[model samples]
Target: MSFLEFSSDAFIAAFFLYCFGFLFYMIAIGGKKWSNRDPEQHVKRWGRVAYIVSTLGLVAHLAFFFTRWIGAGHIPTSNMYEFMTFLGMSIMIAFTVIYSIYRSPLLGMFALPLTIIIVAYASVFPQEVQPLIPALNSIWLKIHVTTAALGEAFFAVGFAAGLMYLLRVVDFKGKTKEARRAQRWVEFTLYVIIVVISFIITVFVFRGMGYEAEFKQMQVNIDSRGQETTTEENVQYTMPPIFKPYNSETISMDSFIGMKQPLLETPYWMDGVNAGRKLNTVVWSIIAGSLLYGLLRLVFRKPLGAVIHPAMEGIDPEDLDEISYRAIAIGFPIFTLGALIFAMIWANIAWSRFWGWDPKEVWALITWLYYSAYLHLRLSRGWQGHRSAWLAVIGFVIVMFTLIGVNLIIAGLHSYAGV
Candidate 1:
């Protein structure tokens, strides 16, 4: 087999191993109170086994990373697929270090799933490695992207721990207004998670069905020379189109369950052919997500948070708070180095400017400022527990919008990463 094929095998191995690791962690945490086992001994044995499996999974993931890099003749983090897979691997690394320090099986129980979702999400993007453009071939691009992803991975871990804390501490059954508000927000958070996973599912499902829809959108651009250029771009959709490109002609669209045409046109405000495609993906994901959420609610007859809240028993909220805080604290400076410092240097070299008010750049700065506020509140205002957990969760959301949303919704110099 070719090196790329071998690397794909290794990637598959890592994915399965991570699944096994999560299963072992579930056993460690859930089977502790079983009828015939010693709870402490059970947790000890299974947690150790889980940690080992997860570590091995991480090793496999590293193998995948390096093999792909060696075969492709470049780091495999230049595009969404490769960068997301690397992000998943980085999250596993962060989880291992933190789990080693704390020895918390519950951390594995939650964090492994987070990593799995990420790695799985990576599969939704195109996997073919492509040569970097000359501007992106710089060493600074490598440093900036890798460090930024690693830092974001830590924030992902922090988000996981923070989510677990909320699930642990929130009084789901309480009828008081504060409790009701918390319950709604927590459910909303879980709904958002479901939406992301639903996105992955939606992509793969339509892909498996061999779905196709095509549109040609005319894009007009004016250059610094005051020269006008118009180009017709073909935009493809793997999923059924809920939204078609604005001011575009349908080239071909396969009928899906008798729906022959699109239901809506992309808003004028959301210009660009790629932006329209991305918006369709987002809308499809939310629709699928809502349907799935409704099904789950029907099955459980309770908010999803309440169902998982029981499993969080005996996991101390205070420890989770600490874990969340430490993960973010460790990530903050790394993010500053990658997303700010190195990024600016690369920007100056590439765009001939140290700063630009690009959408991606603005979001990155907003993420930094938000995290800065989180740290300030935690240290100076003595925020902890519920408030801190919420900040950690929201901060990751901001980080994600910076990383993914801007790439999808806005066209900028950074849009090449989505390729």
Candidate 2:
């Protein structure tokens, strides 16, 4: 088999392994009711298992990606599919590193499922190898794409942690009520997670399975009167004209082939021959993402907050606030350097413009500004805890728009990501 084929199998295996690991985590989280008496004991035992499964899952995930990188002769940041894959790996790496330092399994409770969703989303895109675009063929693609992906990954974890923190603080009168609130919080998080995953999947699957979209253009074709036809018309296109879904084992080339005349006039998703694979890949990813998300919710009956210790013990809530702030302090700058500065430099080199108000570019700026505002409020306005956490949550939203939302929703110059 070719390297891409082997790598494909590896990734499929990794996906299933991640699903298995997530199942174990669900078992650990759901089993909390029986362990209330000896919380630490249960935490230690199951937490160890979660850490191990997560670690192995990460290893398998990285191996699949690295094999692709080796086959492609560069880092896997050449397209939207590759970039999402990189982001997924980066999130897991950040979680593992921070987890080791803090010895906090709570982070995993929030981070691991997010990572799985991202990786699964990546699977929906075409994984086949393709040469880089003239504009994208540069060292900057590696620097810009990797930095942006890593920055988003950090913010993604931060977002989950912030949400969990808020849910934990939703005051309740008694242990019983608090426990019920905990379940509600977990359910809400699961719902949000699944929705995001589902949306991506729906977009891809709907588009890939083929949708009827009318393109308004002037075409020069034979007229009904037998003369030359040069008038603007709305053309509707469909796919899988003859082949059924069961026999449709491969991407449809002729469906969207020979469609582009002026290169820039074409939609980004239909940019090239491999574009079909890319689109199909993304759609499938969304489908898988949604399923895995639902599975996560079903398995983990307990709320994620049920698994976390107070951000600290025997200490004031104020200290927990400070620690979270300190983390953002260290992280925000790295995020700025990676998501904004490096991206600008790379975009300038590739696109030949330092700044264009393109959707992706605009979203990146929004992400940067959102975090900047967060830091400013915390330092200058004396904001802390809930306030800062809320900003952290918003910051990731902007980051998500810049990362996934930009490529999928807004049309722009950087829409090379196979939808």
Best by lDDT: 1
Model 1 weakest 10-residue run by lDDT: 31-40
Model 1, 326-382: lDDT tens digits are 999989999999999999999999889989998889999999999999999999999
* Cα displacement (Å) at residue 219, model 2: 9.7
lDDT (10s digit) by residue, model 2, range 1-419: 86667677877776676677666665565565567567566766877888887888778778878888888887778787888877888888777756676665555766777887888778667777777778777887777777667666666767766665665564422468765665565456555666667756565655677653334444455767889955544433243222112111222233334542212222333533233333443444556666776576468654434434343232244533544554456566777777678878877887777787888777777777877788789889988776776677667767776777678655677777753
Number of the predicted model whose TM-score against the real structure is largest: 1
lDDT of 1 at 44: 91
Error of 2 at 105 (Å): 1.4
Instruction: Provide backbone clash counts, one per model.
Output: 0, 7
TM-score of 1: 0.95
How far residue 253's Cα lies from its native spot in candidate 2, in Å, is 19
lDDT of 2 at 91: 82
Model 2 scores a C-alpha lDDT of: 0.64
